[model samples]
Target: MPFLQDPPRLTNAYLADPLLRELVARALPGALGEVEPELEHLGELAAGRLFAQQAVERLLEPRIEHWDAWGRRVDHIELTPLWREAATLAARHGLVATAYERRHGPASRVHQLALVHVLEPSLDVYACPLAMTDGAARALLDAGNAALVERALPRLTSREPARMWTSGQWMTERIGGSDVSLTETVARRDGDDWRLFGTKWFSSATTAEMALALARPEGAPAGSRGLALFYLETRNEDGTTNGVLVNRLKDKLGTRKLPTAELTLDGARAVPVAGLSGGVRAIAPMLTVTRTWNAVAAVAGMQRALALARDYARRRAAFGAPLAEKPLHADTLAGLEAEREGAFLLAFRAAALLGASEAGVASDAEQLALRAVTPLAKLTTGKQAVAIASEALECFGGAGYVEDTGLPRLLRDAQVLPIWEGTTNVLALDVLRALAGEGVGEALAAEVNAHLAAARDPALRPAIEAARAALARAEAWLAAAAGPAREAGARRLALTLGRTLELALLAAHAQWCLDHGRGPRALAAARRLARHGIDLVAEEPGAEELELLTGPSADGGAR
Candidate 1:
């Protein structure tokens, strides 16, 4: 059947759709670039590689180890580079896209979801001194000398990675944690040389030879606006220190791979980035990518937890049947599946949008969408991933709680997704403000309509109609947001509605594939989820909660 679910469903669809599979195969780049493997988090491909050359007789290495490593809370990032390098090569060689849609088909989205969770890095790469293991300083000219090596030289149509990681990270200070305005990092100008003073608190402050840092020059504007994006490099021909110091590691809850650190900058020399007082503007693009990645990581966590649970249910038996065979267990599985699909759609659709947008081509509209969606991804996915892992473990009873079962690792790893980048309330407020911007509702509506048209599923008609009504009711709720209480209530409704809109768009996209005769599996999955979504939306609390506004009984007004 045409079940257009997330990865597993997508995998079937991908195989059925020859064109998609071919497209992925043609898209992969062979040798010149780095690569990454998505299976490390899912079925456990990494630990397999480590044990490939086993001394045991007739026993091929276990594939399960790679999967277990994903459960490692803070160290997954450390294992990421190898896969990244390989995956990059495959994409470059026309084997796949960074999303790996070409190679894995629809399943690539699943792979990507896994990758982010496993390689999750807590700090913003650009701001984190621990952004990379190796350190360097780069000034303005260096800012323009980016290492988007594969991206700069493009070929024919395979989905572009649309990755926004600049070969840098420059926004942090000894005083800068959540507040950027109070940064004490100094960049002193000396006839093209801007010397830096101070350090970074939790900068993964690693990557490329040069970094773009936020610095305040002598007698600059008072606050964040006054700062400039300066470039710094590690070397000065002496091979010693360029005044940029790698202080120490950050002991944290999760995302400890790539090394979050306290860095030192003692007269670290740098150069003035172009556009005076453009530090904020210069850094915004980088921040957008980072925030988006953070969101992706959260979604990935959700998918991993869901996948783990799904696998457990299929295998773990209780009460004379597999746990998944039980009715309550089935219901739990269904909920997790629903959450996973919704999150996958959110993550990939955002990536697809960013890929389609021109480089550095950010609009207020786009920014608003990013702000509104990213936090939802973070909050919902992070919290849900934990729950999914825990519940999946419950299916296994005592084994699930044990370290050998690896369920605990999944929960522990997901702990940091929401905390990093920005906290929940911070993102929620941003969503509120962004959605409040003029015509956002209309814009969102247009987006939804376009997706619906693409889905084109006759079987989805009932649910679609229901969803339409739900959207209308939800809109009315938004419109009625007047007082503080009303507005607060409306915001909650809006958030749920927004999530619906996100799912609706993806459901529509999946439908478009089936309608165009792409994959039966995707079509089936889409039908199920789209129908479910419609039902959910139609069940608006407001419609039921409020008394019907009607005239008196027809028989007699007094009666």
Candidate 2:
């Protein structure tokens, strides 16, 4: 037999993750004793059967069949085998149901999102539809529509595979991407319902059973103020298209197996969710839920990338020794590990806060902290996911760039994290919006200080001081900068605050580990992240200088 490079294999996701275990134990206490079995089983599935299946399965994309032999408009979408299997797995595991079930009280969300974190990376972006489904459930529940809630909530949270249903979020249009205020979709009153008529430029999870869409009603004003949230079933009782036309399945760079499509609503029957206006306001609950999912997904992607790279380091040989034995290779992997640790803590903190809020156990400080941290976690982890994935790919040399090796997909899929729920810039501005609320910035600072206070280890003092200093600098910048300057430096400020919080949380968790005899690995992570630069805030360039750098050239030539 010739010498062939060994491919990386995942160990049990739950068993291999000391950080998750420790955090769960600390945060959830006795709940881990009950959830451990389920986590262990999901971890096995992720590492074993699903992982093996993914390795051998041929890459396939969803196809839309517009017509049959009779030339009737069928508009049927055929999904990949893995995706079909993923739906059943998702339901049977109670991935979404667990959160709403509140089996662990305020910690149920922690358990549910933990399952998602473990299984999502192996499921080929099945989390996309799940995120929307979770969001739709939250939105419907918050809308206080008794009829709609009764009809959909049970099915959305059902554990039975056959009964469970997924929903789409149809908000994007050609004219409006993030700014739903510019939505062009229109709704007209029918006999007892409304009919949506417009195009949805980018509709992910097109195969979902239902969707929450935004449309301006007839004789209504323009902008998001006049828009109403509507719920529509994708098909009628006879399993026929519900006046929704699927134009084409998108050919994407990654998540190719997931069906994203261009859709046209030609008189799709719908019922108003709340009222005939404030659709944008109504969808806020949904965005909060989905954005948390986005952050967790980002962290999961980073974990998967790091897992593969680390495994390969032990298996692959260079200079007559395993790559893991090389100091430089070890250092590179260590840096990535630190990033993953920081990202994990930050994302999971958001999940924990959400759980508490939903369970009505959150204090005033936690409520305000949740508002600020949600956007921070999403934007921060989104960027880290891409950076870590890129670096992890490089660890594999040329193999990382080869599609057949299944390494390039890590980077491609990670690219969507920062772009999906919101782009980095959009989320940065959102952080500013959260800060605009009274007491939000103070609440966030207090939360950071609370975490930092838990660390008594002298070895972790430097990281703790760094986090505090970065946070102080960010507050100073915010206090001094005026409108345009603040907006211009929003991204830097958001990143600084996010990274500062991550370092603080990491230090606190590392302290817990040290006290519990779990070793100094987490402390090392905190130190490394502190060294990675927690303070990103800088002086905003003046208007004239900024224009000169970013605006069109004097002669109108491309700069």
Candidate 3:
């Protein structure tokens, strides 16, 4: 045989993913036995067929058909076979349905998210629409909207392909992305029905059957408070456009398989899901749900990239031996592994909290911790995924740069994780807000301490102490910094908190592995992660440096 360029064969995702299995076993021990068979099946489908299709079927992309053959305005987006197949597989496997059904109580979310993690990388970005759908369901359920819930919930969680429906979350506009305070969309009363008139600049799931949007009614108060959550079906019963017009689809660097469109809602009929006042507060449930999805997808992408790189390392020899045998390459892979372990712990912790809270089973302290960790996990894991994906790409050297190799797509897709749900800065501020609530910071610290205490390893003591000291410094910074100063350092504080929590969680998992005879792999991961150091927060910049960083100088660039 010549040089033998073959890589390892892809195995079932769930079976191959020992880390996810361990996390699942730790988080939802009882439910794991029930969810295991389904996950194994989903894993097989994902790793074998879905992975192969995504690699060879490079031309798969969503195309928008804005007009019919007769030149009539008929906006329809065509999905590729892979997208359709993946969507069906997702439904059949109970990805969204499991969460809605809550078959396993709070543990159902862990199971559902784990399934999503397995299927995410090969889902052709179908997770985008599913996220919106899940959020919409949660919002409707929380709002006590019996009518809308009755109509949408069943289909949203439907197992049948013909019956299942995805939802679009049309929040972004020409005004801005995260700042809905600048929303120009207006809602009007017409007899018993409400009409929505607005332009949604960025609506993923253009082909969705319904959408949840924010619009202000006439004479409503200004800012986000005036905005109302509106639920509208995008099409009539006859399958005609229900006053929602798809303007155009986005052509982008990544997630091309997702039909993201600019939409116009002209007199679209809608019903208010929550109170007309404080609509921003009303949308919290949806945001929480979507943010969790965003974090899960982020971690899933990281796992996929690492899986490919690790496999390639064993087969792709460098000078004298396989890349896996090289000390430097081994170190790089281990570093990626450590980052991924922390990310996995953080993301799953958020999911577990979401499940507990949604089930109304969370304690007072747990609820506060949930509030802080949700944003922390979303922002931190998203950034981690992008960095890990970049490193994983480099593991393949030149082949990673080649588009046809299916390696570039990993980086392309990873780029969107941090930007979606919320950007880093936006989420950092959200962390600050969550911490501002009574008992949130203390609850978070308590949770971290509890996890840290689980690891009795003397070597882990230093890392544990460093994490506590970082927490103390964060609390001090938050206590001292005020107004603009606090805002300036929010990202640093949030990162420190997020990283500390992750390290604590990893330590706890390492202890669990040690006690359960699962060996020292997890302990090693925790140790490597700790080596990254916990000194994340820094003193505020000097006035001169702050001014230069914040805006143009007072001297108008003359000095």
Candidate 4:
């Protein structure tokens, strides 16, 4: 019997995937000529050294120490070598600093996010803290908190590991899940400083140096309007906890390497980043920044899973032929590729907009489109990651189910995509809200139509028509649906919008390939995605049917 050999290792992500290179070239052709070398280096590191480290450094979870041998209430968290490596790489490469520096103007965001796409999957969940840190920086800048901006921005964006700092987002609490209106955290002023007192549930990246939290002032009105964004450092200069008690680390299903914890504030001192009123509005910039990170991370995970699966297919054999040589296996891989390309197009488009918006170069239409697509991309790509990762795992057969192969971890880690930043349903509601704002839907339709118009390939025609049809249906649904019925079908509508956008982008990429005399990969991806059919035209139910869904069950139980 022939001894089954392991799959060929992917040493360099950029060199391995011509598709990623092509996409970056198409996205920023002029800039790509300059940034290509850096991207290539980053890609090599990701696919080679980082990939090897992840395999060898298995089961590296962060542990929290709440008490010392001497009974000192010292809160210490120990990180694995993988996380340490990720942190060092993040600082050395100016991953966070690049975006803030705006060296490439509007193209800076594109460059930064591209690097993130290559860096994140192998970062051992370092992206979580980095996302929050980026969000915090943008929030501080938008809030125009001069003191906090000067002090925090440097640390947040520093390229030196000793000077760099990660940030935690302490928005979620015991009372509030996604609904910030239910926030019970209280903030009372003591002289010039604000003292926050409450328990924060689900504190991801608990090892960060500081955090951005939402707290309601004592006399402020109720609901989300009363809440204010507060900034707090995790420690004092004396190396003591700043009235912050680390309860315990969460035993999560995935992202176990990440230090997620429950924290209680015994009058933790804080500074207000924005006005006491309209805290949600003040956080708009932060949301824009972080959602883009989530979308990029989702697509990155999908890419990594696909890469591993494709590598495995070449080595594994059945029925006297290699899996890669099997027509059915090829078809499955191509299907996954189509999904990945669609997600990539949608996500990069969002990242580009964010870069433009940050650079103050986005047009009015582009601004509206950015708002609409941020949530759409986040929600869509998040689900796609989990689905694609699961499929990729199956590509390995029995080996994929084995933990030692590092295949199951891809699926486990992908599970966090949908749950992080916001769930699919919550993001759907955000999309609806964006649509409610003037010009968002129109801008989205315009962008999609322009892309569809540019795509001249025969294979893109179906996707073009479907995208147009989906856009029409979305507008109609937005106009007709109201009250609870509108709320009930928000997810369906948001997904339809997201999927249509993806098809439009895929078609556009295919067109780019045609113009550049490239191969059939983009066209193939476009055709497959189009054939999948855009899920845009769900039949709206009548009042009774709507009630059946939203109302109580036969036993009078709530959903």
User: Could you say which candidate leads in TM-score?
Assistant: 2
The alpha-carbon deviation from the true structure for residue 475 of candidate 1, after best TM-score superposition, in angstroms, is 4.0
Per-residue alpha-carbon lDDT of model 3 for 211-282, expressed as tens digits?
889999988988888899989999888877888888888988888888888999989999998867667777
Off by over 4 Å in 4: 1-8, 541-559
lDDT of 4 by residue, 429-508 (tens): 99999989999889988988988988997767777887888888888888989898898789889888888999899888
In order, the Cα lDDT scores of the candidates are 0.49, 0.92, 0.87, 0.87
Which scores greater on TM-score, model 1 or model 2? 2
Q: In model 1, state the lDDT of residue 192.
A: 60
lDDT at position 235, candidate 2: 95
- What ranking emerges by TM-score with the best candidate at the front? 2, 3, 4, 1
lDDT (Cα) of model 4:
0.87
Clashes of each: 61, 0, 0, 0
TM of each candidate vs. truth: 0.66, 0.98, 0.96, 0.96
Q: With candidate 3 superimposed using the best TM-score fit, by how many Å does residue 26's alpha carbon deviate from the native?
A: 1.8
